[model samples]
Target: MAIFAKRALLSTGWANNLRVEIEGGRIAALHAETSAQTDDVSVDTLLPALANLHSHAFQRAMAGMTEYRMAGRDSFWTWRDLMYRFTTHLTPDQIQKIASLVYMEMQEAGYASVGEFHYLHHQPDGSPYDRLAELSDRIMAAAVETRIGLTHLPVLYSYAGVGKKPLETGQARFGNDVDRFCMLVDQAKDALGNLPEDCRVGIAPHSLRATCSGDLARVLATHGEGPVHIHIAEQPKEVSEVMAGLGARPVEWLLDNVHVDANWCLIHATHMTEDETQAMAASGAVAGLCPVTEANLGDGPFNGPTFLNAGGSFGVGSDSNVLISLTEELRTLEYSQRLRDLARNVMVVGEGSVGQTLYCGAAKGGAQALGRDAGVIAKGKLADLIAIDCQNPALCALTSEQLFDGLVFSAKDEVVTDVWSAGRHQVRGGRHVARDQIVSNYQRTMADLLAKL
Candidate 1:
């Protein structure tokens, strides 16, 4: 198949009359200043679709449920209790329904893939399903149905707190010791039996408070070159606990202990000190930042200026799925930094506009974290692209060079008109192909689940 865009962002910036050829879900070749072929699909503008580097699919059904304050002193701990209660009721069918809606929404929002940090492994009663990969299979089914790329990060969550503690009651569904966790991962691979080449399997150590160092090492041994992701210091309470238990801050301890590198994605290292920031930057790992969720949870903003100045790489995610928007996440990341430094354009890389810098940086980091040959519109890469409706009055006034700035900052409407995920046209006219069915299932599932609560 071939697509011709009047304007497109290429490896060498914006080009006109752009022609991209795709074969078997990968870009075959690209040509600039080319005439449209008779069979080519035409588009206004083409942008590289990005990966949502972190997500919890089931949480999408609970986005607005926890918005109100439950108590006078609402915090992440309190919000988590609600999450635990919510996860206790979902059946495999309901899980698939929620995930299908979530992945379809991501596809429409221009995210070609998601690294689902899945931990809901067992039944509500804390019993393992007959098939260890039961929940994983549901997630994969949703991916197949939605036609979105899946980098399933089966979570290894053992303890509820630091220092090898026992699993808490609310954490029952997520519990698995090292041996069981390994078995689940293996069975997940077997269940993933035949999938698209773009689908990948990876492991996630839920967090420092959720697993011990010994188990961390054991899981890393089983890791066969797939990406590794972990939640680091996202809150002051978490850092305090790590200090009391591990005798160092989370980032400091991990830097000293784990051989962190390009393959690792440390999610929300928000509370790193200056020293820790420098060390993390030098380590070559992508700092997985979900600024919208950080703000939602009142988790402190990461030290973006210092981290980037130290030569760090970073990516954005729709964590919690409370809201899924590429522009919102990227904008929030820069806005938070601007507020921190009390200056504009704090996230600027070098010479380009801040919007372009944020997109390109997050693009590279997101691709690295997902183990995908995407995040760039180039030959031999995955043909994950989005075309925006330039006819929108706000977008229509902008020049090709200024399109990103308008889209990222001031566009007032849903300008995205079409999307392609690894050569699959999952979204058109700003809606997923399977949106009607997925929405119907999701609404029914949510109503039933909420009525019981």
Candidate 2:
């Protein structure tokens, strides 16, 4: 297959009248300054689509229900209690339906892939399913239906909090000792056979508060090849817990103990100290930022400027799946920084387009975090790409260099016209090809879910 774009952002820079060829789900060739062929899929604007590096697809079903304030203070911990209760109502079939909807929405919003940080692994009573990876298989089924590239991170969650605590009732479905967690990982890898070659499995130790060092080491020993993601330092309470229990802050302890490298993605390192921020940048890991969900949970803004100045890599995700817009994620990131510092353009590495820095930086970082050979329109890369309507009202007057700025700041997912996940071409005309069926299934599932609640 081939695609001709009037304007495209290549790794080198923006170019005009480019032709991209794909074979076996990877870009086979690129012709710059070229004319469109008769059979090509012509598009208005083309760029490398991003990966949602962190997600809990089931949470999308609970988006609006958790917005109202509780009796007293409301924070991530309170919201999490609600999430745990909601999980009890979801069966494997319903998990598949919700994930299909989430993946379809992601592709339609111009994300080429997702790193599902999955941990829901058992029955509501906290017992293992007959198939250890049953829920994992459901997530894979969703990916297969959506044809969205997936790097499934089967989570290893054992304890409820720091100090090697036992699992609470709400966390029972997510608990697994090191041995059981490793078994789950093996089954998840086996389940990957049902997905495309572009899809693979990785391991995630939910967080420091959820797993101890010995178990984390055990899991990482056998399954350390693909992407390894973990939650770290998203809240002050979490940091304090880790500091009290581990004798160091979360990021500091992990960096010192673990062999932190490029293959690791540290999700929500929001409350890092200056020293921790610099050291984390030097660790060659991607800071998986989910600004929309962070804001929704009242998590603090990330140490963006210091991390960027230290030459860190970062990516964006719809962590809680409360909302899944690429534009709003990037915009919210910048706005959070601005609100913190009382200045604009704080996310830029230097004096350049804030939109470009945010979007392009995240594109590259997201690919690396997912272990994907994508994030740029170059030959021999995965054809993980999106095409947007440059003539859309929000983007009509922008130049090629300013297009990302316009898209990130002024536009919405409606501007995205087509998306290809490793050449699958799952979304077109601003909709997933299976939009009607997926939405219908989700609606029915939601109806049943609400009635049960």
Candidate 3:
């Protein structure tokens, strides 16, 4: 058994200096206002670690490379072209290296878990590897090496666009029929079964544009029992196309079609109407909001106050991995709300502090979206926690609300001094323990990929 003492911050509220005991990768007991004994381990401020509800780990390498001006207006579709070209040259080994680096950065940035929207399945030439799930195996390996809790979402990409169009060359690696996708998911489940129980498998139907209604239904029917994630209404163009092609807006059409619920995460519902937002909130689905990426991609601002008032749930993600910081993501989210409503602290719940409100809401939404019993420091919950450096100037005079505000608004990834996932210390002193080797491997892989590109 291991014991840790700190000012424990539960999702619902905060406690004074406390002692938490862990055994068999779960919290055994928690004692409030407990004095440390000679045998007890001591920590600083401890809070439940955040979960990145959406990510494409391989996209970490493509950060900042796609910001140049293209011929046209350079929308999300244009950015997709760059992403496709970049993804074409990656081998499983390269993917593992990059993913390890990304996951390490996430751990250091105070995210204990990641919901990886992994879709790269086949070789660049569109042929199956000797092991169909080789890429997923590499992702799982990376997560194990980095020690970040993983929700590996194997994405099903059957068609290129609406109406069952054939996948373009760039999308070949991500394409699989429903049956083949299910097979790959099973393979992934088997592979992940060898890892710690904190690692899980989920299904992602890439988007409304990528899969037809029948294909979506079949994939859901085959492997919809676990968490389900999908990109929806990220851009105005997408909303227009989805409406023009399907006779309904993306969110409206999805609500009419799928059984979206708490187990589902609707990524980037950025262009939802007020009615669509309200309906989404009532549907009990978590919105996988990536404010940094949305701003980077010019996807426009989400209706934060409207959605929040309508009882919408949301969790932040480092979607493109251009920037990976729990603090930055949360900050950008609140800042977006500020910019939208021209008001301060627009997301705060009743008499609740802004930082506490954001943290608690994201924790609950992220856990619900990932289908995990996490995001809370309570009995029977997974032991995923992050410790802030009390010595940091931003944390000076840290009350509960101030501590959260400092962590969310002022602190960067470097201030995350320690992190624990499943009662294991994966990060200490603001660094993943294996950062050197992981970063070295990533550098080599990135060098080779860049040389080829």
lDDT winner: 2
Residue 255 lDDT (model 2): 98
lDDT of each: 0.89, 0.94, 0.86
Report the lDDT tens digits of candidate 1 across residue range 1-453. Answer: 999999899887889998999999999999999999999989889989888999999998889989897648999989998999888888999999999999998888888888999999999878999998899999999999998988889999999899888998899999999999999999877766656888888899999999999999989987869889999999999999999999999999999998888889999999989999989999999999999899999997899878888999888898999998888888888888888878888887556677777887888889899888998899999988888888898788888767777777776327888888899988888989999999999999988988888
Which prediction has more favorable lDDT, 1 or 2? 2
Give, for candidate 1, the lowest lDDT window spanning 10 residues.
Answer: 404-413
Q: Estimate each model's TM-score.
A: 0.98, 0.99, 0.97
* Candidate 3 runs further than 4 Å off: none
For model 2, residues 82-117, the per-residue Cα lDDT tens digits are 998999899999999999999999999999999999
Which candidate should be chosen as best, given TM-score against the real structure?
A: 2
lDDT of 3 by residue, 32-58 (tens): 876887776577788888889999999
Q: Which stretches of candidate 2 lie over 4 Å from their true place?
A: none
Please give the lDDT score for candidate 2.
0.94
RMSD of each: 1.2, 0.8, 1.4
Q: Which stretches of candidate 1 lie over 4 Å from their true place?
A: none
